[model samples]
Target: MTMATVRRISECFVKPLHDLSQEAKQPIYFSPFELLFLNANYSQKGLLFAKPTPTENQDFSISTFLDDLRGSLSATLDHFYPLAARLATRKQENPPSYVVYIDPENCQGVKFVHATVDATVEDIIASKDVHILVHSFFDLNNAINHDGHTLPLLSIQVTELTDGIFIGGSVNHLLADGTSFWHFMATWSEIFRSNERDGYSISRPPIFKKWVLEGSDPIINLPYTHEEQFIERFESPKVRERFFHFSSASVAKLKARANAECNTNKISSLQAVSAFIWKCVTRVRRQPNKSETICRLVVSNRSRVNPPMTENYFGNPIQSVSATTTVEELMVHGLGWAALKLHEAIKSHDDTAVKKLVESWLRNPIVYKLSGLFHPNLVHFGSSPRFDMYGCEFGLGKALAARSGFVNKADGKMTMYPGREGGGSMDVEVCLLPVYMMELERDEEFICALESN
Candidate 1:
């Protein structure tokens, strides 16, 4: 297979078409939950391989397609204006603070890049080194969320393939989580599909109000004296990323078996799958029975908050909840027992728990670091299978596959996406040491669970 080469065609910024100069430009303060992502960026890329219709193909042109995408994205930005805004820092403040707000007077629009790949879509999808190849599809590969002050908070790249197109988006994690990221992508696709028609309105316009815990300071102050202190970079170790598919049937069986063993129906499919992965990872690492392992799950606080923030509430309203157990307990307790531990951790993080986490962060601000989150003994689960990843159709058919960027690549980092077949299926993207990945692929128990039913 020939190595895919991505050539940059053009680069520009896309600003909102609707003017908001008259509106009050209040900065949307980042909550403690959102501030946790100050050091990371969320990057995802989707592949669309559906062939165009005969009539459409006759007149299809890459130039025209890109024009439509740009126009629709401009319209979508009218609602999600924060994406075009810059992260501003008040260095003169008592302890220094950061806020995201659009300066109508001088808006730094979202960075847009147009590129072309010199290989077929199949070459990319079937490549053994796909994880390494996908890094070229996204922009801001080396930037963190803190760089948003000088860089665009959101960067999008449209790469055309011989048989398909790849759309990749990189957004500051502090500006949006997996939910908000997909929300913007879905809305942009919807607007693009409605471009030829009239009287089209956004079904879900984002709510951009800053969510603050009652009685907590709206402005979160950092403990750093210089902006340089916020810029911490790490060169991740060599690892391999592989996708594990769990069909709906297999997932259901896992869930059923877990509930049967636990003698309770409260075990969700996510918990069951998480438990299975956690145990498999622990076993593959060959940890001692007395060693402790941790599984950190990223939980959304949108509905868990006091007032229950709307699903459209933009920005990161997520918190990480972990379930820890010794290797012996996790492996010996069986899948049901392991799942129950995850289920309890998720269920116990209620409104009060969310508030308590915020209060604790206020007293002591600690930015997330790869060293603290990702490790050999820790499995950090990010993203979600509930996101409508396959539904991001921009006049083309549904996506053929989804892949993440180079950012956040570390050992034991797993991201979950809804399977292409849908119907409760999940695609677990796992990054691990090369030796561990080789062991995981050869693990009989893990292979049987995925192939069963």
Candidate 2:
């Protein structure tokens, strides 16, 4: 497949047009969960979409797209003020300290890039690997760093294509999780669509109190201070990222197959799809000798909290639920068995369980214990079909498609998001070792179960 040529048109830093008053400039402290992300420094995942065109533009002119986005983003920052703040490290005497501060004065501004591409959206979306399209068109990688010291946690690149435009953004994971991130995007879209100055008229405005999770005394006692010690080295055995589309009907079929003989409870679409993928990948890549393989599902805690947090509470309120089983058992058993294991893992956590887990992590300083980077037996699931990516309407129109820019997707990591033209359909992005991915692609059963893309 031939690649599109992308040329940079312009680049500049955009600061909030309005200044934050002294009362509004109070520094926000990191929670235990937020500290976990801040210490590890996860790269911001992004979503890209073709320019909207249904609604009437102020002038129906082309050149104002970038200007409008920049202006709207600047205005949006007034409500989401922390995005424009600097993460400053403060001296602390405690071990495994957590005194990182988001200083507003050093925010500076976010970087905005405008580029032109010699291709259409379909040219890239129709390809076998959509990750290539994401990498090529959305180019704000340099703006996001693994270190939390960087300011202006968000950056956007708007690429003008022959047929349409692509609006891509990169954010610092320490600043927000997937829910918080999407909330910001939706707000930006609403502001751009309505030409609003602030979020006063918006129904669900963001809540930025730093001590929202203050109920739990956040502290950690660990032997290691350097987070790198927990991360395995990234070496050879090249990895590849591939995307698979499962239509609403296809997902229903998988769910039916999973619950065919079960008398207890029926599995959900996410559980069924996750199980099928897990089984396929494990069967293709697991070694002949028996060993325990694990599947980790990322979970959000906003709705799970005792007094459920408001939809607009912004920060990293995310956790993971893992299901581990021996390779022989996982492969020998049917899809229902695998799906049951996943459902059980998810059911293990509730409001009280989540609170206890948070408190436990405060004392233990837990790090991911998965196998080394290239180990095919370890897989992690991310993003969620629940996030309505296709609903984003930025005055132009709704997003044609959506994607994630999860930098350093080592191997055996997958992200699932709601399919465009949403029904119950889903899009799963998988990164794996080339050979294993080839085996998965060749799996006749897996291919037959998917809807033609």
lDDT of each: 0.83, 0.72
Error of 2 at 35 (Å): 1.3
Which portions of model 1 miss their true places by more than 4 Å?
Answer: 51-56, 93-105, 129-131, 196-200
Which 10 successive residues of model 2 have the least lDDT summed? 366-375
Q: Which parts of model 2 are misplaced by more than 4 Å? A: 39-60, 93-98, 131-133, 139-146, 198-200, 210-237, 364-375
The TM-score, computed over Cα atoms with residue i paired to residue i, of candidate 2 is 0.88
Which prediction has the highest TM-score against the true structure? 1
Instruction: Using lDDT, give the best candidate's number.
Output: 1
lDDT of 2 by residue, 273-329 (tens): 999999888888857648878888988887887788777888877888889988999
Clashing pairs in 1: none
The residue-level lDDT of candidate 1 at 383 comes to 93
